[model samples]
Target chain A: MFDDRSPIYRQIADQIKDDVLRGVLAADEQVMSTNQYAAYYRINPATAAKAFQQLVDEGVIYKRRGVGMFVTAGAQARLRDGRRERFFAEVLEPMAAEARALGIAAADIVARIHQLIPGDSR
Target chain B: MITTSALQVRFGDTTALHPLDLDLPGERIYGLLGRNGAGKTTLLSVLAGFRKPSAGAVLFDGAPVFENVRSTSRICLIRDDGMVGDGTDNLRDVLDMAAMLRPAFDSGYAAELLDRFGLTRKQRLGALSRGQRSAFAIVVGLASRAPLTMFDEAHLGMDAANRQLFHDELLRDYLAHPRTFVLSTHLIEEQSPLFEQVLILHEGRLLLQSDLDELRERGVSVTGPAQVVDDFVYGLKVLSERTLGPTKQVTVFGGLDDERRALAGRYALELGPVAVQDLFIHLTGGVP
Candidate 1:
């Protein structure tokens, strides 16, 4: 189910981060063993193991020796912090640039955002 | 682990493999990619000791492989034609033979796998359909648990659903019992995910070998306005290209550096992942 453009392990790691960020994987929650993930995704167990290793290396998840891995206590916050750090350069700036190229004013974009979120303006 | 030194194979006047040195470390899955006549089968045959090399040595753990029971017993090569069994042999007898031949063979697992593939022990090998024979081949290959197991396209006659089951079982069994697996397949995209490392052969020479991701990074796709794409890819090795109206996409062989990537970003050009299958097609003289 993974593309060959990038390594499948990297994709799996990104998905794990996404799950944590979306609260689908709570802090301290036990995660699927590498075999389970591999079987579910139909990927090589080594690839699945590599993803788990990366997460463990990053302190995004921790292992329990004989038991399975569990999400780090503050992984969601840390993941959100990482995304927030990239929000401007990765997300908002691109949106702003695209809006500018489309001839939409900054104020107009702000108004649209407000309309969608309805008073979340800061 | 298996190693080959100055190994060469010939068929009458045709040279199937050139003098080459190679190593296959144990306990990992490897994908072998090549077009037809790429010497894939020849290479696998030599590894399995089915054919003696015309020149040089094939060794397992430093000992010779040809007629060396120590090495051959630990190596199993299941060819596409299900060469592991005689056509007249009953399914049960075939598995029994395997268990007797291969030291690590597990008959119970073979039975379980046969059931999964919907094959019965009473069927004669000659009476089953092509797909069924392939499924039986897979059963022997996996159940053998050879330290070095090679499946030369295990899904040859199976349908898509059966292929999926094969991949699933391969990975699951690999986790439970790790071993070295070399899978020579033309279905690159469908099967490459199961590979940690990939070996590509062209003609009789080793073209490339690397981690699958690193190999993938060797190629990239650049897409943008036709003019922008042309300008951005001026000096790069373009493998293929397509243009539709104002937009264009060019497949570049070598990857772009960070500076070029940032430059593409400035030009609003999109950098996409080139599928390994596409890379293989272009690398092997596309469409020829």
Candidate 2:
């Protein structure tokens, strides 16, 4: 769950972003309070709060003061934009390198992607 | 800063702790893990100034803590025995005392904590169940928020849910205000994540004190065909091993790099982590 190469809080923040983009969490929706997240995840609340702070810094979430953290009104768009920017590093680049090693052409992969979208006639 | 020099403790003929030295920097949660009678309690007691070391001194910020009210006031130690006071005192009095004496005490938070723990102010400390006592101790430990707070098995009687609550509250309170928290517990795996640094004691001796994250990265487990794993582990320190059917799992403590990984892969060996508890048991000679 934790890697030595990077701070755990950053990884936690990244995971939260992935969740937000995947629609596992909704914008303007209240997220788990830091204490709730810490206990639920069995991690230090400070570390959890750091992760939330990272989201706040990135405008991915906003704090409601005495209440708790809520996904911002445009949280989904911000998350999608942020994730799209990193898609190549996180997904495409690795897949492309592996495919090249396997002698699979980029066109072949694109064809597979379109084939998997059964209703996308275009 | 907290420093102990040549600290020694002896209970009659049994030496509880040998002459030792240690230094703890400011504002970090330290996990003091050891088996029973491994001197955790003794060390914490001395550091908290509840007991004077038989041979040596404990200093807080360069000043001796023993009999030093100013220094002692900055520290709160919650042990299984609770505080030495009128056991008849209701929980409210204890909270009041904490709020009045502890410079950083959070009375409002303490009240909320009491409610969360289902402990009422009017309840006498003596009348409370063991679990309730544990809860009460934890409340004091968290709410005190002293510069240095030590909890020595302070929640031994708490149920799993309440223990979870205790950990959550501890972290939340620490974040709200950072301080030095030293927790001594036998439940290593349960509390390992809370620790930035771990000080492990074995048979009254300081075994290791290192960054918990780094300690975790020092060992790896390799499993594969018996011959391959054996060859890879040859000349390497084997901490433990288990064999069943056609495969063997060997735990080796050392570096595992890309080269080692490729070698293991070539030999059809699988590499994984050695759980902290299993490693601790191996390190401590299976003490309790």
Candidate 3:
């Protein structure tokens, strides 16, 4: 089931992106048809179709004539790169701001990060 | 497409539905929400050709549907009162009648639904429980496969589990065979998510009709420090407000654009989606 934090279509798109990034849905693999997805999720068909259309627009999926949608070639790589670019702004910035509010220094946060991942410096 | 032109239905001295125009294009699901006596059923009855509007016309594809056999055959309306047939008739008898009448009736699908709902064809309608009768009505509605199918609180007597089954089956069938569906119900919270569009009625008048997503975007709750929340909601239509110590939650009726949302984010305000049921109650001034 979906939550109210965002639009359902956006959630659907994000879920598909997550699947692709995790290799659960490999590139060139056919995704469920919009109607199938809608029935499975118990959501409006139009809403599910909108999510598919968004994926299509973002080059994550493509339609073959008279056939269903399939993951675009290199979609996972493109998604990972996009997520990497957003990591600092979307994840780290908020964490850092919260740390500052709690009187935690940036160096201490970095030390904790190093402790969590002993081999990674970046 | 189904369109109504200034449609109004009056019985004796009381007006059931006020003059209003409505357009329902084919191949979509619509949720009709209204308080009791808000004309939801009246509007649906007019659309289904069960009653002729006193002042206006109900048209299907530009032809009047009142008493038109061809048009009525393509439209099906199932109400909560078990309007399909006599109470003594068996389930199999009803299905037989449906197959003879409905041009697109799917007997195999009906049989499947009957089994899924745990309804035996040998059971008499009169002897069945309230929930069983509702399940039978829903089965007929689904298997009828009419171009325009309307269910006016047809699942009222059903238990929660059976109701969920009915919703699942309805969606699956609809996806398999695309058609137009209008569902009028008081259980908006559970079923509103299935609707592509929503029609809200108040006091025999159409309150609003909009895409479900757009309507959801119209109302949002913003929570933060009292002053910041006040400033953010200033000059907006505030539907409800709550305060606890230094924090305040204000529900506003308007779209929040990116700039305003960013502003909320900067202020550390929590913005949450407003439930469609809450919006309906606030809009209609009805008690929850």
Kindly give the stretch of ten consecutive residues in candidate 3 chain B with the minimal lDDT sum.
Answer: B279-288
- The TM-score values for the models, in the order shown, are 0.94, 0.76, 0.94
Q: Give each model's whole-structure lDDT.
A: 0.90, 0.83, 0.90
lDDT of 1 at A86: 97
Candidates 1 and 2 compared: the better one by TM-score is: 1
Candidate 3 wrong stretches, greater than 4 Å: B286-288
Off by over 4 Å in 2: A1-42, A45-122
C-alpha DockQ of every model: 0.72, 0.17, 0.57
Candidate 2 matches the true fold with a TM-score of: 0.76
**Tens-digit per-residue lDDT, A1-122, candidate 1:** 57768768889999999999999999999999998998899887778888899999988999999999999999899888989999999999889879888999988888888999985758
What TM-score, to 2 decimal places, does chain A of model 2 have?
0.83
- The better candidate by DockQ, 1 or 3, is 1
Interface RMSD of each: 1.4, 4.7, 1.8
Tens digit of lDDT per residue, candidate 3, span A1-122? 97643567888999999999999999899999998898888889898989999999999999997899999999999999999999999999989889989999888988999999999977
**Could you give candidate 2's per-residue lDDT for residues B40-107 as a string of tens digits?**
99999889998988998899999999899999999999987755236899998888888888888888
- DockQ category of candidate 2: incorrect
